[model samples]
Target: MRNAWSRAMVRGAWLLASILGSSAGFCEQMNLREFGQPDGLGNLALNALQQDAQGFLWAGTENGLYRHDGQRIERVATQELRRVAALASGGGHLWILSDTGTWWWHDGRLERVLPRTAKLPQDVPMAIAARGDEAWFVTVGGLQHVVVDRQTDSWSSSPVMTAEQLARHPEMGRLASVMLARDGALWAGCGDAICRWHRGELKRWDARSGVARQQWHALLEASDGSVWARSTQATLQLSAGAEGFVDRTAPSDRGDPMHRYPLVEDAAHRILTASQLGVLRWQGQQWQSFGKRQGLPGDGRVHALLSDREGGLWLGLRGTGLLQWRGYGRWESWTDADGLPSSVVWTMQRDGEGRGALHVGTGRGLAAFDAAQGVFRQVPLPHAGDLFGLVPDGQGGLWAATDVATFHHVRDGRGLPGPITTPGGTEDGFLWALASKDGALWVITAGKLHRWPEAGRGPVQAVPGPPGNAQEHFYDACETPDGTLWLAGARGLARRRAGQWLSSLAVEDGVTYVACGEDGTVVAASEAGQAWRVRTPGAAKPSLESLDAPVLKGRMIVSLLIDSRGWLWLGTDAGLVVHDGTHWKLLDRSQGLAWNDTSGHALYEDGDRSMWIGTSRGLSRLIDPSQVFATALPRPVLMSATR
Candidate 1:
């Protein structure tokens, strides 16, 4: 606080708003500069969202195919199965299988045509399943097939298998269902028998061996991906390797009447057995019946059920509001009482962690959840959470720079361990927060760019920058993992690399911060939010906004931070956003961000996936995630980035 250099830092922070007063002010007048989805891909009905191994969301909607990377949704416009029926993925790319052929979303690019032909099986994929290197899908033609050779990646009109092979297994001729078991084997639930195809061979097992008088109804493979099936008279569990079946519904295992439509398996030990009379959960040893006796949708016949991200089960009663199980013997109804979209939830998607949210986007804007408690709430921002720059802190935390402020949080629901403070207070601000090579926290406050040894084990320290004229004046500062500092203010942008303050980026190869990878490039953005390196400042990279004034009017880019995943998060005046290597994604209210636009003021990471986004209004954290929903599938709604 006694440093003369720190005094200069406080006086130089006003240069940004003053510069914005020109172009940004003009756009603000016209109200043309909005931050979110101002144009394209209007509220696309995102029915299916899955995350591939690479962490990108492959969305299959009622309309077309989109690739969402948590910030922006990319339309596979060319020939990506419009009105896409079923979506399944494996080996890194998304398989957009329609009624005719497959469109491969592979290698960060879309191949409009994988292969489709009328001469081959009818392509309307009912349900697609996959194992390690292989995948199997059932077409409306009643046939189960695999992705035989993606390396060679060739196919033909003729059957992938021989006619003799098909003749030998007439039971598998009409494929009804399929599932990829936990052990990486593909299970084909045909009308007669369920065959296992994996490791270059196909094997068959029929239901007659278990349910003598019944046929297979449904199949569910859980997180472990173990395969389980239910028939009219029995519930069978597939052997780990899928060599045979274990029928649990014998007279000993409870010879209950078999369920007709829904058969959900929990890992492999339990099965949700639904019958016209009632519903029961069959663990390895017992059948726990739940119905009017247990407050499960007053009706004895439970038709449909949806579980939220919070482990609360929801039952879709034939004639009642959606029901929720609060705790032991406690039921909360979401009829007209709460903000439920409808009493009749034909289908629901429990997302964000099964702890919150049940997206039922029917006729309204989009109704589901508003995360309440927990340090890391998965609620939507009022409108924007688009991502921009990220610096993954390796310890399960990330640093995000939004259009608003810096943001950092763990993806899981766990809250921060303690109070987050920079080396100093808010006076050295506007853009004065960053991390150091040894995980030190550097911030500009009062009269100096303060440096706090991030762990607190060391003494609180201060790093002084250029002085300014007024007490209200201050500068912006960001640190890198390598001890470099990037600071900006009324004067200009400056960085410290080799123990010296370089007035420009060129001294450090035009990098804002010390980066450990090829992605360490600093962007000097101003003038309609146009960006280039500070060195160039006018070369084109990608447009954060196409319109100039709309952003100035309402939504301004408030913060920017980076995550370990190499993506950029932007906290904008409108909301929050993220930028993957390729696209711009707006992460605001609709996608479960905080209600306030000031959510990310000072961001930091914990070296893991944990991110802490500090807003002027409140503090928010995204804890380390427990469950990762799949975007490589055609299911319903958001992922790392919500729709």
Candidate 2:
């Protein structure tokens, strides 16, 4: 037991060191900066990566395509190009082969290589090979050649292999990969053998030629006339010979670190390969390994590798996002000490004066975040409390909901001492939510609702609860432009206008959130992921339109905010969704979001129009949402000048 305890202690110490060793210099060696939902990567499951001639890195994920310009990352919006299977560069353009079809990205945008009017013989393209004016797409059914007609500036595609040719080469079953060899030969990896096309002649090699008669997943040609093919269990090196190509597999004694993935040649001419265990590099004669001991994340199960022009190695881990090896031996990571005080952020409110600042309600206390300074300043509350809600007090002060009581705090971090108390003065149930309308403060507590007039003379009055079971709980509340109070509750949604409470829309499950849009569009979301976009109340029949955004249809929208530009931002269980009038775009953990559990009423759009989201893990601010959209969002005139 003592020995086991000692071993556990050692492991714990090592983990602590990995997390807290700021001066360890591992950042310089790995130089790894991982990005996901917070940094705007569309998906964590990266399928392919390529660097364009202009030094822009293109990452093809399962959900979207991303471009990195060494400083910022942005998603490239390409229609029907979600599941990228392979990427190739040729003819001064980058060719992207997705599950749907093939696209060419040039001049900062993606355009389909084939015309929309022309349909390919097959729909799913598995691999792409491009050289000079020729490009081949190996689809699920057969091989296709994309032809460019410069005369009409039109594009067309046709099958490369005829029915009789396919019948002759029976071994070309479900082509997996293709590459252009240095000897001007077109090599393809198929299920049963490697097919080579030279001088208009097709040749196949099977196990009789020392090559395994199994699926070859990838094929690459080295500068030294050697061809590398990844088989089901090992990597084989092939060389041209008199009778087909002669091949040899890597040494098996080292546990086969290739992981059935392709071998990538780095700038130094070393072959880099990845497996389920670690990453190995063949330096001509010997193998060098890198894994967790060398600061690689996860089980070292990398799926994609790239050697950039800047002499850095990039590893795309299976589920850990992207990591770069700068070979500098140092690493630095941000933490709560940097600015944020608590990981459990419950609510966020923008400053009323549009000062490019926001106040965050955290599990610890209240914190202020300045967008210009790019830092968080913790505002120590007078008493120890867990803050759940925050709102502008209309007098440069702020109102906060806490476990003990609700207090109005000044802007300079001093909490004024007029504690709003319940009739019983019991501290058992804490206040959970806060909203203000028409000089009246609306507060939701654990047990009931309280309304206090801003005149500072009347006692806190209890508003009649929603007409339902006595135990119905409330989640959020908002006010419309016409002075109507909207409440989200367990039974449904309620609105109180002109001192009369009216039960509005009711759902079987419950309405958990409500946000008032700029155009009097009342967007209310239920616990069951159902959303209704209704116009202003008191009309003969307000049109109730169901939201059809695919990302928000079946997910709980924990947070909702309608920005000034009329874009509806929703924080759901799966990720973040921004609906720009016509389409919805999702940003999730794959995009670098710190946490998916966003707090209700925690979405804030600051003066600079950047969105700050409060989540259970911490606070994340999207510096610019327009960057996600390839086309810029329209801005209102005179508003920019006023700011």
Candidate 3:
């Protein structure tokens, strides 16, 4: 039954891609799959990937090393060897280099390669190249080589290139990529040039030889003894020249070179390069690109690429996690199944029939998040480029604000036929804010404010609020309990009462967000992370009271919300700041947040008071604010002692 359901979904995705004019058979020809924490990957921030001789793929991540067979992934249990950066396999063993040190796996047992007392120039090894019993290690100090001594159950390393020899090369102490040539010589790519270390000497060619002196990202030696070198701008072929290995442009590389890792030549001799734009290949004399449209996960750059022996291509994307594409147009993407649609989430809200359901505004569109299922059901909005904010429409539905215009979705899962455009609104100005108060709908454009009296009962009219000269600088606005609307502008906060415009508070740094506390206290957040309490007067002018908090002094506040507990939740560029009338506390990525950079107007609290945080990376649902600062239960005070 599951197989049948998956087949049906695949068909639907293929049909949708076809209608969108994507690559022919994009969904049918390729299947993309991603793997991450849910699949037992130690971390999402991947650094390197290597397929061992045993057909198992090894991944180096920030947390530790993970090994994946054809079926499952398992974390390699090493003694204090976490935070791996690179991996290599050779001589029936796996070489691992991490911040901790270097280790090699042999015969189902892992052993430290470096002696405990050996003094190395640099502690961290950046790149490794291995073949047979010899492996090359590149570090900030210089290039070194190690020879495995199986008979002695030990390994020995020596300097392959002296610092003096490397001084002439580009990015001398920063050798990033290395590979072995067919002639038993070592080739390495540095920041400035590609060098060959042969016969105890170093040789290099630069822009003078038609190959520009840029960072050489990767190097690969083909079966036919042709070496392929990749730089940010070009890919070159180094064949056997009369004097030595001469460099020439690859006939297949016609576009800008992907600044990714090394080029891989598959079993079919097809040269491929994984890049931010997706995977590219040189086939039939031309380069072909495959991206998200071609069904290769999110459009993040592919950090790690592997050409499996079974005719499959594996990719480790920075944001999208692991993706696999088997031959015959099959691809699959693996990620946090319960995470946001895109890491760059813009806004989020809680909606439901009394029970909270997550609604996320993302770069793609609107998504309905299922907390129990840990999945997001995407609901694409027509013509909505980037959703910015979502607000409850008093009737359980929501008002969605986008880059183009404001859209209204009615209760009972129905949407209006067209956008709710404000009359006399600037066509060039993007929609910034949307709110409904006292049976009136208010929309803020680049420079002007539009209001629909009686919540669309009357024709839209341009309401005077922002200054005529700088209409585009308004950031946010909200309504107080007394039907008074507050606007945050470049100057500061302004209030409108009974159709009369009044400047309430002005600050030099500008105000970005405005929220009304339950006790009728109007809190205005400044772009520089300062908050001011406004005293809403009945008939007199409003007064401003600065609410000083050292914790939020320098941060840029993106959104401000007053929860039921009367705590002012300020979403800022640094993190989340909570002001409980007097004291201020911070919650950030270190405190269980998926991302620290919060988006403007992206904070929402459900009836249950679970805070929903929208950030530049993804959406975070915090069940209890107190849990952020988890404290160990008070140890039973057996006896009170005075020190």
Candidate 4:
């Protein structure tokens, strides 16, 4: 069964990709969040940033060095080592260069490279690069190399290029930036040229070698094994076996030749940098700009940039503090401040036919999104109350349920007088959930379950639920493609097949949500975050298996959805967790979610496959969720172990 599910997921992912296409407008925009003194960084003028082996981010500022572990920032070094210049991490140690001198941090202890009694040259260090037990520093005077004796906690320093070598190649002096490439070669940006040191041979490139003579201030080895050099004048790239570098500067940067932008390569091997205009990404042999028009916060100049292991882009603004861009998808949010009826969104459904407007149910009332104006307009309903359980009718209308009543044929901001009635034609109380499949609508009111036939041609039939507590309330329900109906609520899970209700499947905690997969499988989740998968849902002897995901162990799951791509999305009290068969990833406020606590029955997939999450603060739309599945997973290798 697991193999069959995996095959379905791969097929669905490919189909989804082809359907989405490669339109320019389909690309995700940059989603950025800024952090400042409020987020625990004492200083805003960041000088350098690096990610260590353990995945912690190190930020250097004028005051001190701080460490960030995705949540909070704490000062790790004293204030005496002021004006940190550069940082590099490798071999389980972080090398630091500051105005005072050079230092290395290991196992929470910081030690100066040289004691105050034996100080080295007083020239300011421009950049630092590390590999294994060796670190290199580029300074105004020359390039310095340091080797560490880890066992003895001692180190030795020497000049990489001696004065004789500098005299032979005059253009290699005045080094500014350095990078240790994956090929074990040391690349440096000299004042008037770029140099590569491999083994004992040192090669230089200057105007004579068809390269620009501007001072290169930054160097990076991209994922494609190409070396990129950045200067205030232009940016250049050197391909694997290329003799010289090619000027790949953006056309816009050619006009302003003095803008110094920080450069970093993202997890996707795309070159990323930022100017006063906004963030720029190198794609299709050109620079694509994402500026204030694309929802970037504060127009301050970006000073330091680093791409973390999780694919997030970090920008250290000159004075605006730190900012992180969520790399998966662009998030467009709306709240009361953005013309939403209320900040507390309960449910959402797409209205009309193809690519229709989204109708949302908020704490105050209902509102429809006007994509053209990029704002939500209040759609007044007959009963002014909080709404939930919104599902689309077969026609260009909707079926919505509030606490006191349920309405059908809800169109153009007005609903018809249609409510769920009992067998005696009396109104039911407190409608809780609604589901539609094969033109048949399933309604759960308080504790009673009813089936409303297609187009309301026949009378509503009150169905008998699985035997359990008389007052057991139903919270959610879904119907598989095989005409199997699954219901989840306080008591647990129940299924109905061929008009016959089966016995109740009791879980540890009462199941609160249920979702149907395209392969006739049903996934049910309890409030305690325990989830179970039922295969062959239409069969009399269906098999049940528990989903083992440590990330969802103690989370309070409020909503569950199995998207067309076979990805399971869980809306929980902490955040939104998605499992793509082999891996689980969390998308919270840190990743551009409006809020961590998602609302019940608030997870919806639009006609375009985008996800809409309704939170207490507002609503967020995750554009192009298929991007997360773009990268292929590595195949596993098995090994036999002997006891």
Candidate 5:
């Protein structure tokens, strides 16, 4: 008993370490929607982006101004205002700045403002900032300001500071970018310094004031009213009432100079920026990058970014057009379009060599996951058949089973010649499941159980199945830690204990799947979605207890898994369901799965504790199960009792 207790403690410690260690570097799943010429944008080089109050996205490209109404993009005809450089929206208007001139769109009217005849800077507009009816433009010549007369439907422009005023305040001249804070303060990026203009007062922070000595290129105000300044070398932020700007640049930014792009804050108050590496989100006092592995399409260099009203981020790439990111979540999927061999995944298992690669068996053939590239590469199989079962051989090799035979020692995309022939020459039958226990392989096929030794010295031996009068069509099998073999099929649930078949639990519908937990707990389910749990599995007198899983009723449960945390996961026809001891949760298409119908024996848990579910349309992964199940516990309530 003491030894058992010690083993339990060791298992608990390992489970805890796995959960904590995996989460430290876990990447949240991202859903991305790409928009390009196929969607009506004339040019893919998006230079500026903005979303209006009505939820319409305005994109400024190198050729013309385009508007996306959540469905399609159409160019807003501008007579000669081409080569759009920047865009801003304020006061029920979207302001467009081009090399030709500046224009504003309001209620379907495009009016050109601050033309060359207006005596504005001839150096070209680099950035624009707007608030209410007023707009500010930063040009190499200086800063320009424009105000609209709503009553008269007109506009006027003037230099923010005259030549004499510039001579007095040289630190605010040669402006590059500008931004208007929530508190009505105007911030601008000067040549080598950042300046703020608030209520007729000017404040400047330069190298002398501890600011990084680089060309300040962009400025932004976060939701919390903190001003962020982006320079050629670093990114700095200045809080309200702070003495000076604090450098918040990531360590990786020191080597890459492309991190000087614009910064935008999401609705959650987290700051995000685009770079050559990918989208970087500022959280926990550091930057977390999301690139192709996180589902960002294209080269990851975003020319412009906008956080929309729906909490979605719009990324404007250089030549790849527009992409809408739904932000990080627990679910992500990959389909055949993402380089998978087939969408119909049958089973998946981790590489026994401990390389962290997942080998997937699909209807077409076998494929291996490429974690670095975020895609799947097909692993050529010697035999041309749909693989239904895949398991690690516990000797740095893999075992795959098809309808006719089972191949062992599959490595480096090659399978050995020797195949354990199916028992009874059942060429017409299908191999349902395979399990490895005590260095031996257990196979279930056509209602019969067979045990094949690892040495491969003799022919396969048939084992006694559970006692049942009905035709037994076995579908799944699992071995408990106590050397008991549990089988599920048309005959219901059965177990082989101490070399003898035990009594089987007969359900109204035949059981199709079974899973064994480390604590000697056994769970079995039927196609009709009825589930039963055995707390004292492998015991002399084991009894089945019905689980109160109403959500699973009427659903086709294709796969079941008892994860290290003791949570029950069910891959069903509708979605992926989980019972975290008490409450039940479902994740489907709305929650980021590619498809609703899951494949049989396609549920897997990797060394990192992340759950992988295979569906008819694609493969889906749940990054961190603990985050989904870490719901707040119910609080105790006091009740008044009547005497």
Candidate 6:
């Protein structure tokens, strides 16, 4: 309650008193601080670094790569002074590779290319491994073999191969990069692929061609010959079944804006980082990037987020607030301080002409905001109401749905008004979910579904179902990509597609809830722990599964949200389950999703990609697809116990 200096004075007095007095002899002082970038690394962003076999630590910096030998700092430059794509260790030297294949470095002198006829592509150079006199370097451009003739102190090229070259090599793609495994098996990230070279034999692995995996990034061969490969997007293990790149933190992530920090996958060291941008391996040397790539939110737990046709971000959050990621790692956030009603916004919908309207859902009522009105004005409705959902009908007249017993707020002469007393069926339970598909308003009632066709429909026709299995009531309803109108019920599942009541799934599948995504992925949760995901048949799926998250094996997942990355965010009773579908990781009291949900409750993804979990302990959030916590948890209001 005091000013900064006053607070400082109080702290100083406490410290002085603790040091001078306290018969208990415990002299302790608390120091609070706002987190910022690492100070020693200074202002320049660090990307990555590698420790060579010797005692030197090579650091990747924004301006240039630096080599430190405990005493002197050596500045590394590209062969042509271009942007250094990355630096790797090979043949007892810190090899500096640029985005361009034109390899160059300073062997205790000015930086210069080692020996390459062309420039590499723009992807950062990942790994460089040396075996005997033969050295291998991987770049976005392609893979190259550099032979260091120690006898002559010179370098020679074996062959320059690109992904396309290897693809056309009459075999698989060229090796992206090569590394010596702990078991002596040579693994190669060939082309957009992976392969093993053993006993003068090259065994190529490509998940796409039924080989193994394509987006191969790095390969790790355990001491027992078990192979682990990290894909371009997910992670995969050989003996454990191949998968994509993975997130193995407290909660695995997929680049959400709600998180304050990001969860970047570090494939090089096989660690998940919470830095700024998502880099691969980090042996404590890399840039400070904050987003889903590392371990935080990409934007903020965006209560509402609008993406422009140009892919720019417009966010709205309750706590840490809003932001817009321009590109790469550049983002901008808007706040009430910057002209807005409040940050507790809810749903956002894209209107005509590529414009987005953000519906700010506060404790009071609903409001709207866009580029035109930087601030929000309460939607003029009949009475005070709490907004539940907002759907933009592509036409000028948008539909705002609320949950105050009376739903529907139509736009009249004023901005938004009127709770159109649409007949909510002759039931008593609340309308838990809403959806509009195939030109019809699909509303889920307590035990049945009501469809109001816009073609002169008065009362919504209630589709009758087998008596309310009182024990089981519908929670949510959806029209799947397969044109099946499905309902998430308690005892069993129900569906009505074409004038036929198809409740066969009830007898077939043991499901309690159903969540179908536009991505043809149908996930249903059972009363038991197993969440059956009936994925549409696809090719090369098993090979792309990542067994990376070592945590989410047995969590009884309840609610499922198919996020922007196409991964599923499973809110469980005991914890939060994150999986690209195949491989899963758990997030609980230890990993952040600390809700006392021994019995699961409501789960939602706010307008922003932030996942909101409503449990017994109130609400928790997962900003970074990996982190689940209560960022904007409501503080309890306690009246005086007595006079």
Model 4: how far residue 173 lies from native, Å: 1.3
Compose the digit string of candidate 4's lDDT tens values, residues 150-208. 78978888877778877876555667677888888888876678898887688888887
The digit string of per-residue lDDT tens for model 3 on 1-643 reads: 1111111000000001111122221111234456877888758767778877666788877777888875677888656668787788887778888777777888877877765543332222237789888787776556668898889978888877666666665354666577888888887776577777788777776666655766676788888777777765577776656223344334433435433544788766777775556667765344556665455666546667777654457777665666665322221211123333554566655544334454666766666643333345566566445666565665566666665555556332235554575554436344355454566667766667777664535577777654443353566777777877777777777778777776557778777678886666788876666788876544467778889898997787777888877888888778789877767888775344546677666677655566766665555555556543445343212101100
Residue 522 of model 3 has an lDDT of 82
Comparing candidate 3 with candidate 5, which one achieves the higher TM-score? 5
Q: Residue 116: error of model 2 in Å?
A: 49
Candidate 6 lDDT (Cα, 0 to 1): 0.42
- Which lDDT values do the candidates have, in the order given? 0.41, 0.60, 0.62, 0.68, 0.68, 0.42
**What local lDDT does model 3 show for residue 451?**
75
Q: Mark the regions of model 3 whose C-alpha exceeds 4 Å error after superposition.
A: 1-336, 351-357, 370-374, 408-414, 423-428, 454-457, 466-473, 536-539, 627-643
Q: List, residue by residue over 366-477, the lDDT tens digit for candidate 2.
A: 6765433444567766644557656577766667656554554546344566655555425534434444557777766555677777623488887777555445566667
Q: How many residue-pair clashes does candidate 2 contain?
A: 21
What value does the lDDT take at residue 637 in candidate 2? 26
- Model 1 C-alpha lDDT per residue in residues 58-162, reported as the tens digit of each score: 545455665555456566664545655456666765665654465556556655332444222322233566544455555544344445356676422234345
The clash numbers for all candidates, in the given order, read 132, 21, 20, 0, 0, 63
Model 1: lDDT of residue 635: 32
Global fold similarity of model 2 (TM-score):
0.49
User: Candidate 2: where are CA atoms >4 Å away?
Assistant: 1-50, 53-335, 350-352, 369-375, 422-435, 455-457, 466-473, 535-543, 629-643
> Positional deviation of 284 in candidate 5, in angstroms?
16
Where is model 6 poorest over a 10-residue stretch in terms of lDDT? 6-15
lDDT of 2: 0.60
What 10-residue stretch in candidate 4 is worst by lDDT? 6-15
